[model samples]
Structure formats: C-alpha cells, structure tokens
Target: MTITELAKQWQTVIHHKPPIEKDPTSNDLLILIPGNPGLVNFYICYLDLIQQQFPNFEILCISHAGCDPNSYELFKFYGLKDQIVSKYEIIKKFVMDNEYSTKYNLYFLSHSVGCYINQRMVKLLLDDMSLVSHVDIKYVGLICPTIKDISKSVSGVRITKLFNYTPIITVLSILSSVLTRLLSDNYLLGIIEHYHIIKKPALVDFVSQLNYTNSTLGALNIVSKSHIVKQVLTLACEEMKLINEEKDINDWFFHDLGSKVKVWVYFADSDHWVNDKTRDELIKDYYDEDNHNNIRFELGKSDDGITHSFCIDKSVEFARITTNAIRRLN
Candidate 1:
C-alpha cells in the first residue's frame, strides 16, 4: 500500500478492496482514525480483521500530518485543532471527488482522541447541507474514546503525573527517536517475540511495520505542549458537564449527527484514561430518552483485562466487538 497525499501537508495510507461485483448495491467505505501518536500501522490487525469480515468494504487509515515515521520532526506546528481540520478536509475531498457519497456508504471508526476529530468532521458535514444531503453516513464507532475531561480520570491523573517531568519525557522522546533509526524491524520484532507480548503472527507482522520515531514524537508533542493538553482536557470536561446537565449535546457538539447516525461506543471496563465514573455517566447520557435509539453502548468484560491501548494487546477481541457492533447497524 502506498501513502497518498490527501491534502496540502496531509498524507494517508489507503487500502482499497474493490467490490466483488462491478455494480454492487453497497460499496461501503470504512475510515479508521487513530489517537495520539497517530500511527496508522498500529491498527493494522484490527483493520485486517474488519476487512476479512466485510470483504466488500474499502478501508483507509490516515496518519496525522507530518506524523509519518519516515518524516519525524521534533517541533511541528501541528495541534489538536489542526489535526481535526486536516482530517475533515481529507475526508470531504475524497468523498466529493470520487462521488463516494452517492456510490458508497460511509462509516467512521475512531479511537481515543480520534473520536474528537470524527465528531468534528461529522459536524462539518452536517453544517454543509449540500454535502450532507448526498452523503449516507451509516454508523460511527468510538473505541475507548477520551471524549470527556481525562485529567480527573484514573489514567489522566497518572499521565499528568508522568508529564510533570518534562525533562524525562523529552529525553525519552529523543532517545526513542535515535533508537528507532538504529534498530531494524526484525530487531524490534525479536524483542517483542522474546517478551511474548503478542502471539499472533499476523498481528506481529502488522506491529513490525510501525514507525517508532513518529509515534514517540507524537506522544511527546501531546505531553509537552500545554495548550494541546489543555484543549483536550477542557473539551472532554465540558462535554461531560453538558451531558450531566441534560443539555442537547448532539445539537451543541455534533450538529445533530447524533440523531442521523447510529453510534456504537465501546469502552474498556477498567480504562484508566476513561474511568468508570465518567464512562457510566456518558452511558447514562446516551441512554437518555432522546438518544436511546441512536446510541448503542458496550463495556468490555473486566475479565478480558483490556487497557487504554487495547489495539496493542487485545486487537482480536477489539476487532470482534467492533465487527459485532457494525453488524448490528446492518
């Protein structure tokens, strides 16, 4: 798969699966967006699983602008808002240029911070009556979404504590970048195998393709930049507050896409980044009479031991749950 530049300064890895029939009834497209450290390769296993289940659907995963492993830079002028806008532009261009809105059904699968971008993109589409009227967005699946203030959450507090040591994070980022340049994919694979971190051969291959330097730099940017961290935390907190107050969160944030699109939200039972308290609160909000029909929420089994980064350790289970969720939409 080659990386294509979708927009000015934005590049994405595309995986196209042509429809079996020349004129199939449904030519659906599944777009996956990763969270902080937005490395598209990290979701390869999950992508592969979904493709296997729905062979007719084409999948596209976009990395953050300038976040590709080959072009790792320490100081890039990219932030949360910029990332979201870039994604919106990329998707809008693709759908309009290919007439995908008329030819295909659209589904968004977002993880962590990508859920924010997905919501913003949906809002953009909703605001453009001309564009939205033609587009048929069937479903949106948010996996381990960090949509509310995480600072007060279990994982947020821990991450905040870790970020308090700016020097350590910077040093680690620099070291990781340097090591990534020196180490071969095989060497990394060997280390992972030695530790038995992942047993599946296909998943191991997918992970081997990641760009560590880019991921490290992406992580560093999110941790070191006060403004970026503040923005994410604030958005999450405000969203929860509105939901708790029984305000029209859909109208306020999603531009009413919450009503138009079927939403499946998957949350890990013990996610540190999104604590149980906040997760339950959001579930209650989604279950409100107004949203009960549009939103479907699920919590991962506590015995499964899934973490915030389930893509790494629980890819198969994650894929299974996502597949089941999408099936429900059908």
Candidate 2:
C-alpha cells in the first residue's frame, strides 16, 4: 500500500498484510512504537525485514501526535502524560474496533523513548484486566531503550548541550527544511549513503519516499523545547531511581504479567543514548536471578559501528539481531 493510504487520523499508520486464514494464531500482529520524531515511514526498512522473517504477522506503526509538520499545532498539547495516554487509547481503540483481541496475538516492538511508553502501556494493561483479558500479548522487544539517566548519557549530553541554545536549533530546523526542499531525492540519498547513515542500498528508496522536512522539523522541535525535553528526561530518571529500590524492582519488572509474555531488551555496547552504565544498572536492578526465564538481554557489538539509531541505518544487521532474539523467545 502507498504511504498516503497507510496514513490515518492523528498521524498514525497501520500496515497489514492480508491474512491467509481465519485462525487467530495465523493472524497474529506486530505493533511498532517509534521513538521521538516518530515517523511511521522511518521504520519501513525495519518492518520490511521483519515481514520477511515472519510473513504471517501484520505490522502497525504509530507516529506520535504532532510529529507530522502539517499538524504542528498539536505540539502545544504534547506533554509526557498526554503522549502516553493518547498512545494507549489509540492501541485500545484499534484492537477493540477490529476485534483483534479475539482473533490475533499481539506483539509489541518499541525503540528509544517508545520503550518508556510501552512500559506504561503494559502497566495499564496489567492494572485493568478487563481491557486486556481477551488480548494475547506474546512478546515485547525494546531496542536501544532510554529508560534511565537520559540527560547524563553521552548522546543525551551532546544533543542537550547543542539544543540548549534555542536560536541555534531553530535556525538549524529552518535550514534543514529548506535543504530538504531544495535537494532532489537522489541527491539526498547519495549524501546519506556517503555518510553510511543508510548502509543498505535497497532501503534508500524507502528513505527517499519519506517527508524529510517534516521529520526533521518534528525532531528539532523535541530537542529545542527545553520544557518538553526536561520533562521526559526527569521522568525517566525518576522511574529508574524508583526501580533501583529493592522493593519496587520486582513489581516494576514482572507486574503480574505472568509466564506467557516474553520480553527481550537489546542494548548497543557503544550506544551513547543509553550507555553501559545505565544498561548495567538495569540488569543489576531488574534481572531476575531466580528464574531468569521470561526476560533476556542481548548486547550489540561496539566495533560494528552501530549507533543508537541502528534501526534507521543498520537495518539488515538490526533485523538479524532482532530475529535471533525472537527465535530465542520461542
């Protein structure tokens, strides 16, 4: 289907392949939640790889509200709580409206800030059994999760330091928009390829098809707005600190989700956004020593030149790693 056809109200996109049969297990779905600048098209390459691995699963990618430049007005209301609540509501509505809970096993795949949002969504599902009783959530994958001390992380420090200057970010945003408009898609693809931002030649076509200007603007807005960025960083730090407490760690990890749901967390060894310190802390605090059955962690190779945004550039390697993790879950 075309990008326009996939686009839905509130800047959401749902991509699904037609089911081959009426069986619930055969019609299982994978829902993707992207990080900041949450452009659904940004994940096209990653989703394509996943579809190749599991052809039976339908995929849905939801962009954050106001991520689209055309709906920039929604930015005013895009607070932390608002984002989580809206995402939760959107997922609930989609599942209920399509009767997916009765016919499909749902899987969640989240990246960066989406991991935090997905945790909250899972907490909500656990809290209200009535909402998720019929739903079969098979697995959850969190890639490059920024779950703690984000402001202190290498990438966060670099990004926050640069974006601390409002005028600079604003100017950069405008310049980016202008450049995106001026450059031909081929030229842009060539530039990205030269920098190795997109290693897979096949993915260049999909990247070129996206609205670069809009995506850039959305990303810039997130970094430039001090209040929004501060709020998110603060929330993550607080949650991490809370989880570190001995009493809360178990509930934070398990939350009565039971044995059926499997969670896999993939961390990059050299990820500046979520560094070794944070990753180690999470493992120390939440890694279950007793059973160690449902949760697992896989670390990426630092020498592989994988960045925190591996999904965008290292699509093929990222897919292989994620596919291996999925297989381990089964």
Candidate 3:
C-alpha cells in the first residue's frame, strides 16, 4: 500500500481499536498521549522509530479531545475549550476499565501539555489506589513537558492567552485555530511558533508531508467544519479565564507528584518557550529529582545541534536518541 493509504488504515485501526491494546498480554504497553492540539501523525515518526528498535512491544496513542482532529467536529472554536479537563477524566475512566493494572507495567510517552494530563491522571490513580492495584506505571518519557512553575514561567499575555480576552485574544485565537484548520496541518506559522517544531529538513515540511499523506488535515477539516471547534474554543476561553483569575492566587504550583510513577524528562538546554526556571521547579518540586533518582533528567544539548522540537525532527541522530530512550526504558 502507498504510505498515504497505510496512514489512513492505521488511523482507522486506532480509532476503532484503542491504541493502548497493542499487546494486551505483554508485560508493558507504551501509551503515547499527545500535547496541545495535535493528531496521531504528530508522533508517527517517533512511533516508527520505536517499532524498529523494539519490535515486540504494544503501542497505544491517545489524542485528547482538544488535541484530536476528529474531535474538532464536537469543538470548533479551539481557543475557548473548558472541557479539556472533562475529556481527560474520560480518558482516565477508559484506562481504569481496560487495564487497571496493579502488575502490568505502563510506560508513558508524553509531550508538552500532555505531561500535565499525565500528572493529573497519576494523581487520580493515587487518590483511590484500590480502583487500581500496584499501578505499575513507570518510566514517563516527557518531551519538553509544559508543567510550568506558573509564578516563574508564565509572563504577560502570551499569544495563546489571547483566548482570555474575548474581543482581542479570543478572536485571534479562534482565527488562528480556524486558519490552521483550513490552511494546512503543518502550516509554517502553526508549525514553528505554536507547535514549536524547530528541527531540520525543515520539520514543517516533514510534518506537512505526513499530514498530507495521512489525511490528517482532511479529517481535521471535517471536525472544524462541524461544531466541535466552537465548543472546544469556548471551553479553552473558560480555562483561560480560570488561569487569569487564579494568577493572583499563588497555588498553581504542581502538587500532583506521588511515589507511584517514575519520570524521565527530556528537555533542551535552552528553550525560550519553556523557561528554565520552570524546568528547575518541575525537577525540584514536582518530581523531586534532586532528592530522588527515580526521576532522571536528560538535558539535550542545543549546542550539539538539538532544539526544542527534537521530538519530531527528521535528523537520523535525533531519531536514534529518541528511539534509544524508549528502548532503554523497555
């Protein structure tokens, strides 16, 4: 089959059958949760790398409501999505029902905001340990996780925070979201600034090619043309308001860390988008890597030609590092 056809077939299988069930009887299953607005295509390259290295593993990729192109039909606006938290709750329920593993080791591959959801899920699991026994979730692979030390990381109104102001930021956020839906999944502006893919062979072209081949853009358009974007955008606006109003309150620091899971953070040495202070706090406060060796930090050297978006870069060396990490965890 052509690459495009194969991509579509894979999407079909994933949608129909949970990606997490790749190896139900296996010792461990890799669950990849995407960050921000993204499709499975975003991580296909990485998945390909993992498959080559460890051919005997099961891989499940979960695209959250706000992140999935298919969900855009249920949420069109994009900038004001409040149901994100609710969507995550649903995912939690799914995990509980399918593999409430006390013994089955679960490894996570998360990127950016995906880490936030993963942490939240871990907290929920910790709350009622009986709902799950053992909860053998270990080795979280976070690619530039967006767990911000709110006080230090978040500055004034970021371009994304436009959703906080209805007439100004909200309008722009909606416009950009829709424009991205219409123009291209890997559109240059969307790829670089918002998505932050700073790797070579022009990561934009690489992602764009995948989107085109995989029909990701088309599926996304289907959802965008529906009412999903509107609902999701409205939800985002509400969340933005919560964020804004809560700024005066200094309690947004991540208190979700527990001894249930181990973490492996992969971050660039210098990423302007994700502040260093925030990273330090995540290491110190959230994971307590300073005190605990369970959570390991691998600072990618930008000087050696790595950037913030190394997760999806086309560089062979970059691919090797990424695949090796997943293999080592396995």
Candidate 4:
C-alpha cells in the first residue's frame, strides 16, 4: 500500500472515531503498538486484523520517531513519508487524562522494537495515578521482541563499533543486491509470494524473522551513505547513553509499577531471536513468578518446536485463546 493509504488506515484503527466512539458497553480496549522508528505499515496491518476480530475494543497504536528524516530514515527511504511519533504521545496523554473516567480491560499487542516502546509506555501509565484506576491492562502480546543482544543476533552489528568502517559490508551488500536482482525475475516473484504468506497471523512472525535476516544484509548498503547510516548510528549511540544513565536494564524494563498487570510471554520454540534460556533467566530474575497477586506469566509454546517468530504461527489460535483466558482474569 502507498504511504498515504497506510497512514489513513492507521489513523482509522488507532484514533477514536465516530463509528468507533469509545463505547461504554465494550468490555476491553486493545492497544496495538509497533516497534522501531519504522514499521508503520506492519503495525497498522496487524491492528486491522485484530480490530476485525475484536470490534468492540479500542485499538490504538504508538509509533516511534525512529523513521523520520532527522530520526531514522529506514522506512522513509522505503517510501513511508511521515514520521509521527508526536501523534502517538498525544494519544497516550489522552488515554491518561481519561483513563480514570472509564472502566475497561486493557490489552496490548506489540511487535519487534515496539515492545520496548510499549514497555516504557506501560511503565509510565503504571506510574500515573490518573490512568491506573480507569483501565486494567490485563494482557500484553509481544511478537518477536528485540531482546537478543544486537551483537549476537546479527554478525557485524557490534563489530561496526570497533571498526568504524563500512567499506567491506557496503560493497558486499551492493554487489549482492545487484546479483539478486539480476539472477532472475524469480527472485522478485519469490519475495512477493513470501510477502503475502506473511499476512496470516500464523505466518506473520516466521516471515518477519526471515525478513529481518535479509534486511540486515541490505542494511549494509545504507551504511555507505552517511545520511542513511547516521540514523542507525545515532539511535545506537543514544540507546547506549540511556543504558549508561540507568542503573540496570531489567529494572528499567520489567518494573511493575502499574495496576495489577498480568503478562503473557509469547515465544516460538525455535525462535533464535529470543534466547529461551536467557529470556527465562531474565523473567526469573526480574519478576517474582510466585507473586500471583499482580502478574501471571502465560508462555506460548509451539507444539511442533517452531523457531523464534511465533507471532503468526498457525498455532497462534492456541496462543490467542490462552491470551483471551488471561484477559478473563478480572
């Protein structure tokens, strides 16, 4: 879809509209937040699917400014023109202001880098008294959250810091793109076919994993252009600076300062992006699993032993049912 069409669809799905006027009869509110400075299209598309399934719920999206001209140009370069993180904050503030006035169970479906942004927003809402009483944020659905240390997830992401050079990777990337494009029309056709398969809630995640891997190779080419590379570089630098400012990463991330929020941890059995042992360790260290008072950790597992991208797995039907069961808590 074109950028304008995507934005319009996003606004329709996220913002409170005439047809979707905040209904008092609705039992729950669904917030669909996307990851990174890019991915506006993916966020909206997923939200559209969920909105259809849960029409009564209010589905809102929070987009980060990582894809703007001054921010991250990854998406913009790919044709997503407007980078509007400011609009997301406005919606969040609105939710906060009236959070106490209404009573609705809250659900958050976040993807990729969006998971980090949602975590921060959830933290903020938990801290704010005005919003805490109005809604019960019962469940959070995360799709392949970016938990893998970049150094380990992708080969040279970390090494870039040490080398401060982009020649080798850049040349390889450009050459590869040329070769792939020249090989045959089959290459492009294959990509198009894969793109369609990814739309299914079951296949969405696996496709995402493949795309992420492919994109990393393509990303090297962008590094050759200072303006393009600056986006990733600046974000990385700022992220590190933020980490240094904080005493601990888990403390910064998993703090349950909000109203009785239960968490639904979704993962594929074979997901390489999410290190199962490490994630389990983090969960054990950060959250007191024994404390049933506020948190309930419902893990989504693939019976067939699937890999990291479990978001759109065919087995997600089970996962969604499990998620809905969590929502039925209060």
For all predicted structures, in order, the TM-scores are 0.76, 0.74, 0.63, 0.57
Candidate 4: residue 285 Cα off by (Å): 1.0
Q: Kindly give the stretch of ten consecutive residues in candidate 4 with the minimal lDDT sum.
A: 75-84
**Residue 221 alpha-carbon offset, candidate 4, angstroms:** 17
lDDT of 2 at 325: 84
RMSD of each: 5.9, 5.9, 7.7, 8.0
Q: Write the per-residue lDDT of candidate 4 for residues 1-330, one digit (tens) a residue.
A: 433344443332233422244557555667766544343333333344455555666666544433322232232222112222433344445455553345657777665545555665666565667655566667765555554343333322444454464454345446544654565545544553476534323344754454433343223333223333433444443333332212253455555432345555555455444455645765676556555445544455557544443333333343344346445544
User: Residue-pair clashes per candidate, as listed?
Assistant: 4, 0, 24, 11
Q: State residue 322's C-alpha deviation in candidate 1, in Å.
A: 1.5
Model 2 has a clash total of 0
The candidate scoring highest on TM-score is 1
Candidate 1 root-mean-square deviation in Å? 5.9
lDDT accuracy of residue 229 in candidate 1: 40
TM-score, candidate number 1: 0.76
- When sorted by TM-score, best at the front, the candidate numbers are 1, 2, 3, 4
What's the lDDT of the predicted structure labeled candidate 4? 0.46
How accurate locally is residue 156 in candidate 2, as Cα lDDT from 0 to 100?
Answer: 65
lDDT of 3 by residue, 1-330 (tens): 432243232221132122432444555556676654445555666665565565544566655444433332333343312223433344344445554333546677777656655655544555655646544666677777665542233432363455444455345446656665677544533445444333234444654455333433423442333333443345333433433212221123222243334556787677644677667755654555342555556778756666654444433455577676765544
